[model samples]
Target: MDPGFIGDGRTVAVAERSSLTFGVEEEFLLLDASSGVNLPVGDDVLARLTGQASEQSRHEFRQSMIEMVTPVCGDLQQMREHLAASRKAAGDAAAAIGAQLVAVGATPVAEAAVSRPAAERYERIIRQFGPVALDPALCGMHVHVGVPDRELAVQVCNHLRPWLPVVQALTVNSPFHAGADTGYASWRSIQMERWPSLGPSPYFASAAEYDDAVQQLITAGVMLDEGMVLWYARPSARYPTVEVRVADVLPTVDDAVVVAGLVRALVATVTDDIRAGLPAPRLRTSLLSAAHWRAARDGIEGQLVNPLTGVLSPAWELVDDLMSLVGPALTRDGDLQAVTAGIDRLRVEGSGAERQRRIHRAGGDLHDVLVYLAGATTGSVAR
Candidate 1:
């Protein structure tokens, strides 16, 4: 399929084969179905997905969790339906072995005191990454939205820096770690940054500049490679997509779809704006981190740093405003209803993080979280 974003010239191009190809990867903690604790279940699940869905379930560093990669979905609705089917396949496969699937950027219950997952690759990763591996409090859902050209991918990544926090605020689900509450919405964001490349990337004038920056980070031990630079926004070397690595794991498949819609709309909107000669906002790197910290620390309870100006703003208010910012792009790209409707649905009921906290407050145990995971994972998309 022709890439959706503009070519190397930075002009927005009509997506040829697919309007916009997206790949959604959800990182899940595998728990002992009977015990409600994390363990290495990735290898077995990956093996199962091979014959079943096949080629989509690849290995992640963690043993206890599986990363489900959906096929390139051209639009938001297709992305939702494809992801829903993929999750179903993974859930049924995991259930056969007394394990269950979960979605969260960080699994608050197991992150602080991670019990080993059964996979050998995870054991290898643990041995390779010592203290960095111990927190066990992180899980993340990554969405890759396709861009047409290598240069365009780099440009979109550069433009994407300021908006990263918006998704972080929207998807903050992890609020507890260890046996006690961590007092943060998505503590996993901080924990994942420990891996070297965990935040926004600097401006890349061209693809070569992007590559050089990636190389320097690796040489400086800031990153192992382009892959290790797990920035909130980065151009994928393998696919013609820029992956957004913010959003905490959703409690349910429906929540994941909501996030996916916003991500696609953001990319389309920004890409279109750039093509129209509207410059992408430029904020200092430090400001980006502050916004992230606020979102991680407060969830929806406190105001977050506005990405455009670095001013503190209420999370709810920010959501309403951001929806307006992306309104035209969402409509032009045909994701308007999905994106707006998704956010509206999320606001009315509550977020996955709120539900997680509520469950903990009522029961004060992992049992309720586990039950929430199971019920959410197995059920159909909520209306």
Candidate 2:
């Protein structure tokens, strides 16, 4: 079947392919409305959203953070609607307590101590990782795409390493922290590196090997459990999917959809390649690390290190290359147009980090950044 019918110069529908099914999990910062600083009110917000059917909001590792999980969706429209409704609900709940939910990657003016949930596992994390675990005031967006099985998920993750930095560049945010410009597009990305298990993982030969490695991390006390394997891309421990955790939580729901679509396409394309017996791309760990750092530093405004040759290229050109790489899968899933339009919008409006700097450069303070983030989170801004 045609992915979608183009009739009267309009696309009538998107594909209902099984490969299109995916879900998004986003984290947000809760801030005091009056002070524009991080507020440890996530428990209050989740309490308020307890009975809402819109979307489920949960407390994260920090009391100042809230997370939203979208039900598995088959199309970009469904994902967007779910995220939008959830953000609105969370915003309303926060407002009820004189706070606001800001869709930002990190709190610009706060580094409060970690206020973990009541779960014993969370308490274990604080005990194990100590100050490093408490240093993260970061919010991130995680995209999970359905995979056929564990082996395929492992292979896809192996093949996904080199591309992870590019993904971060596309979704970079959290440029400012501690009430000042941090000189990095995604400061949250930098912050997360403090965790030992974070970043791209090595190529695993099979599912067994991957599981063994995670077990080793647990046995050695590097992490507490499978849930703490926090690679940029990993097979979800609790879900039958591959979760890409490279992106910072974007301010707008539309941008989140775009990133999620790209993630799904990447998984599908890599899975097909692995099945076809194509060799996974290999790059030195040093090069991959540099690439990730460069992506975090400049986002799309500067150069990105080429994964193949370790050469720096214009970020936009490299992004075009990524689009080309995932083009076939995107077209097959009927997400080509949506993804294209989304990238174009991002180019014009800039990534969340860029937008934040734009506001800050105009003499707007951190409070202004919070207000702008709130507006963007609710889709009130044009972009």
Candidate 3:
């Protein structure tokens, strides 16, 4: 089939035959440099950034958090360079204001008051959700992979559902919250469950069905807007991409690159299957939710619900399986080697959650964990 052009006159490339563009958005917490406590100075940090860096950075839900988004990137190397530069710019800006940028899922130390930014939308969210919106320290990394259209994006979401848990396990970074270990690798994921629109997106056979589902949520006042559809993966409201929101904000640029590569590869692999008329796996939403919980609870250290067979298996085995599944796509994009090395590093150094736990165990406090995260955020620490 000749992939027709969209209204914009650009050629609609098939994913199986062409490399898709992708980008990443990472959220970071601003902390006091010395005390390592949450600092509500994200605006100050944003003010310090100039030029393109300023354009790419913005205030998050809370005054203590800042989000840095990369421009659309075509390959993993460009993605890495952009992520590293953005992290540095944000980190530098934070340091100038006597703050540090820490790229973990959640702050370990408790905030006396989680301050909301001066936005009407934020105020409305807080009023509607009440206490759930109060703690805005939960940070996550969102990856956007280009798709041809909304219909294809919806189909990609269905194909991507089964692997959401595996993605979560690989990027678990929040082990501690409020000065105590939450016993879950991604405490941010558990905290996010307080909202109504949390967890894996339901399977939608087409774009119309997906639109209707989101509309229903809005009609029922469950979601403030289409942007508030907080599923693990969804059709992007602002771009021609499928946004994957499963992982925690990682501690380093290298970690973020690995995730971006894998997500794009997965999208490519699924799009290829779609082009070949292969049916998407019809897994239950409940099973995906349970698998997500397990991934959040144990990360890569315990058993996960395997996507190939709905049985429990070692997390690394699942990771390996995922790599095998997407290997061809990764290779085509020249990302396989870098992704493989990154995974090997994760195996040796552990996910951000395990590394935080290790640092806390050695240093005997959450402050020590924060110190390490502050350094890791900008690749200042020795590996």
- The candidate that wins on lDDT is 3
TM-score of each: 0.88, 0.93, 0.95
lDDT of 2 by residue, 267-359 (tens): 888887887999898779889989999999999888999878889999898889889999999998889999999998887888889998998
Instruction: Assess candidate 3 and give its TM-score to the true structure.
Output: 0.95
lDDT of all predictions: 0.72, 0.82, 0.87
Q: Mark the 10 consecutive residues where model 2 has the least summed lDDT.
A: 1-10
TM-score-sorted candidate list, best first: 3, 2, 1
- Those runs of model 2 whose alpha carbons end farther than 4 Å from true positions after fitting are 1-18, 50-55
Per-residue lDDT over 239-332 for candidate 1, one digit per residue giving the tens place of the 0 to 100 score: 6678888888787767788788778777877777777877767777788888888888877667889868868988888887778877776787
Record all residue pairs in model 2 with backbone atoms less than 3 Å apart, i.e. clashing. Answer: none
Which prediction has the highest TM-score against the true structure? Answer: 3
State residue 369's C-alpha deviation in candidate 1, in Å: 2.0
**Order of candidate numbers by lDDT, starting with the best:** 3, 2, 1
Off by over 4 Å in 1: 1-18, 50-52, 111-129, 380-383
